[model samples]
Target: MSTTAAPAGSQIAEITSSDASLRRFLAGLPGVDQVGAEARVATLATRSIKTSAKAFALDLAIRMIDLTTLEGQDTPGKVRALCAKAAHPDPADPTCPPVAAICVYPDLVPVAKDALTGSPVHLASVATAFPSGRSSLDVKVRETADAVAAGADEIDMVIDRGAFLAGGYSEVFEEIVAIKRACVSPSGGPNAHLKVILETGELVTYDNVRRASWLAMLAGADFIKTSTGKVSPAATLPVTLVMLEAVRDFREATGRQVGVKPAGGIRTAKDAIRYLVLVNETAGEDWLDPDWFRFGASSLLNDLLMQRTKLRTGRYAGPDYFTLD
Candidate 1:
């Protein structure tokens, strides 16, 4: 909850409104030290959790998951099934908490919305040419509108990493600004929360990850995401650790709260707990909630459920007890 003042006539105020000024503000931020960051993550990853604490972490990880299914062959049936599983992850055990949301492609938003109706599981759609981000700006905005119209509660948009890497920070910033404008209600209020994916795998360095995190936040991202799950090295500990630190710093500098999601390659209960540990130790306890932090993965939920079952039943349930989505 700490905040740094954005004084009048300061760079913070200018960057908060202008693309050119935002570019300079991001560029002027200090570079990240890769070795130091990696070492810190490595150390934090070793923190051990015993019985009750482990059980708490397991359930918390489940609630923070954005159970995702983004495939070329995705169908309505697939989305409906995913929504059911998202709402009641472990049907046998009412103690198992529901996931934060069910993420799907933009086209399947209606299907997911219908399936998730009357449930706490939110329907999130990946819009703006996800995974590749090769579409035009107009197409991106239109797609986002379609998803919102289809009843998507959240919109996850990928930043143009190609443009970002080429030093077209202004273009990238402008695109996010326009997309934020697109995520509006019929009454002109906020419609969907915007998650800007940096696709950290393609960004190439921790410094780039840090810069992209700030860029997305400054551009009005409700959450800064790590990857789109189509890229390799998606959502690594070092990368996510950097993003968590970035949100922590951004909140202090601007007094604005931005969430963080680390998607892809997080398939085990231990891995999910490691991420929660990072959030607690690095981002503080303030971000431990599902609204502030989310894990975007499909398989990770099953692992967490299995572990939850083990905690409740005094035995490991293995993977067979849970339905694979």
Candidate 2:
């Protein structure tokens, strides 16, 4: 994908009305043109991504992990060290389990990749001017391409909220399409996976969330993410439910599988569990894999360890090891 600026007035993803119901719904709503941010989303994400014995045993288990310690120096050595810790914890907890992927910023993709050399933990980098998609298209694409070239196994790019809110669906669609093309991995075994963040905090209503969720999926998003964690109104169970429903609907319509990521403020084990339940109930068994579902959290790892340590050993592990991702 060439790094080019956006064409003025170009619409993003195309919305199709299969029937009267959908057409009426789209016609009645004031989409990107009439949205306003009011109440902030206060839903805190906890380590609730656990499953029942049967669900854990029978269904594919995906653990969402975070390296929430982004505050310190983001040097390569530090990143590599942290990645090593993520792959092989200082103290292994059988109950804590293994995370499917390790998420970090674009600058740290290589660090994470190097740190997780032989482990199954995929390196995921946040792209598209993450936490905010207001940068030039060229810059965004360069960031994504660089991250992938640096060895990121997955690319988590935030969508252009401004374009989406302005009813510019084509802009959003084209951006994702280009970014996905840019995500080719180092060896080219596979391009980095794309997870489009809608910043559901910005997409207020359930109807709009559902519509945008489907739009991102159609635009070639491997995963539909909830928020960027930078916004106050981040991921919420209710909003996430709407997103999962959208994915389910999209699956029914196109027979394609897509993923969902609920990021921002997911703190404890309980919160993660709730999201897992919603995904399990709404999207069925197909959406249960780490490849399809992820929790973009920075703090949940520690809480889960603490909980697991308490449960298994009847002692709480000190919080010194957990860092904010």
Candidate 3:
């Protein structure tokens, strides 16, 4: 519940002691050899959404991303307008909820952090050579520190997925752990929550995704994310399901509540709903809140708003009504 970011050079406070049953569930389970495709997949399909409750939860987790590429001379105008859309939830379509965070690159963190002030919505920045975690450790650390100093509430970093797949898990893990250490806010109170991007498309197999997710969690990842918006695959349900289950497993092991963010290519209410179902069934109710979950999207807000407007007023609101860039 503390707002202060964790300090640099600080050790990742292990969460394994979250709950006894949770640990028991997370402990010494089989590594890839222990799982079977037929098992969870069959159940995964059965639990897919069938009611409004499922749809409602999906809307809550979809966090909007306004890329830096989209912000030019009108950065302030764009940010203010973005905040307004998120703050004023349309009552007509109550189910299409406003986003939890507005994501951007480190340079724009202040712009967004300031715009989101006084609202529950948090400001997140992609740091450490995002979309391509190919940079010096010093640069990554500074990038993270600068973003936090600029008031970013969350740090989303790409996991050197290429290294991990090349059997360099140590490199990937250490970078995340190091970045996590470097992310404390200006107050030096608490470290910004770390979201490690697997760039699942690059990770390839589910086995690799599973391995990367677990490794990042072990090294202090607060959230396991899929793709950098620049990736070809972005976020797919199967890949996301793997990440969500990993969160559940990590929580069970460390008693820590990690969040899940499926970034890239998620643009509609239906796609969001499928992810909601995946989380609800795999992680349960404890993970439902915005603190523990989110969806990375760029074009979802307008669609959600249009639908909400339609559902509420019985009149369709055109695409121009929402400005989610």
Candidate 4:
């Protein structure tokens, strides 16, 4: 499907001008078929790639990783090491592609920036009371600005699920818009890309996932992410399928193309490839690159490395061969 030009600013504004309009628009969205979605992902999961194609997929999967580390104990040294690993995933193999970006807590953005300076791997910071978007709007906005000022190429912000579930759609929408504005550099340079996390596990249903996806895109999110990796039942194939469908339809309506990222609980090479296939099948080949899709994972890189080694050398490498994330 081809993407047409986006509607004028006035038309976009009318849709989100008030809570009633936002609700009416969101309610009008087509409901998701839970069984059909689950069935589709189940069928897609069984399709296997072989030999040369598998190699390509492994490398591509490696390139799509965000290489994240967001724990309370994360130190500058840890952030630097993660950045180093992101720059050169498998140091012994020069052919191994670097990850798409390095995701860290906002406080560690400076450390990561220093480590990843001159590297192609983008630096991402989780802001806006990340993993739990339960803070004052002022605090969230300030945190987003701070991360951007400190050198974050991307900001992964969590939407207030409490407000969303309480039917405060306008509150969540306005909050996202405010944070999107905060992404701009103080000097008026390029804005840091915004990835709005739906935290799908908390969202409770596939229908809600679709609504939240549309809500985020409408509010100017560059990417609609599945989870923060903190919640249970994170980033399942069926959930990702719903999000992929939202983005595909979104692009058709708005000229702008949005991205999809399935974070948390996605660890194995097989799991990562399954997500790649899901994106290819649901969102089309337009999103096959790292620019349009990503896997927010940490241990996932090591697994992809091990699988890549097995494919190239005809044997599996021990986990010890790669650095721990």
lDDT of each: 0.87, 0.68, 0.68, 0.91
* lDDT tens readout by residue for model 2, 1-325: 0111211122222233233332343444333212221111122233233335423521222255544344336677767766765665534543344676777778777667767888877888888887778898899999998988888878889889888887776677678878988987657588778988888888776667867776677668998988878887898877776667667766665667788888888887666666666677667778877777887776676676665555556677778755544
Q: Between 1 and 2, whose lDDT is larger?
A: 1
- Could you estimate the TM-score for every candidate? 0.95, 0.79, 0.80, 0.96
| Number of the top TM-score candidate | 4
| Candidate 1 lDDT for residue 70 | 93
Candidate 3 per-residue lDDT over residues 1-325, each given as its tens digit: 0011221222234433233422332333344422454355445656544446643544564443332332335466676666666665453445445567777778777777777778777777888887788889899999999999998878899877667767665676678879998887679666688888889898777767776777788778888888887878888877776777777766655567788888778787666666666677777877777787777776876666665566456787888766546
Q: Local error of candidate 1 at 298, Å?
A: 0.8
Model 4, 77-153: lDDT tens digits are: 99999998999998999999999999999999999999998999999999999878989999999999999999997
Backbone-clash count (model 4): 0
In model 1, how large is the Cα lDDT of residue 298? 85
Instruction: Name the candidate, 2 or 4, with the larger TM-score value.
Output: 4
Q: Against the true structure, what is every candidate's RMSD?
A: 2.4, 7.8, 7.2, 2.4
> Where does model 1 exceed 4 Å of error?
1-13, 16-20, 187-190
Q: lDDT: which candidate is best? A: 4
- 118, model 3: CA deviation in Å? 1.6
Ranking by TM-score: 4, 1, 3, 2
Worst 10 residues of 1 by lDDT: 1-10
lDDT, residue 2, candidate 1: 19
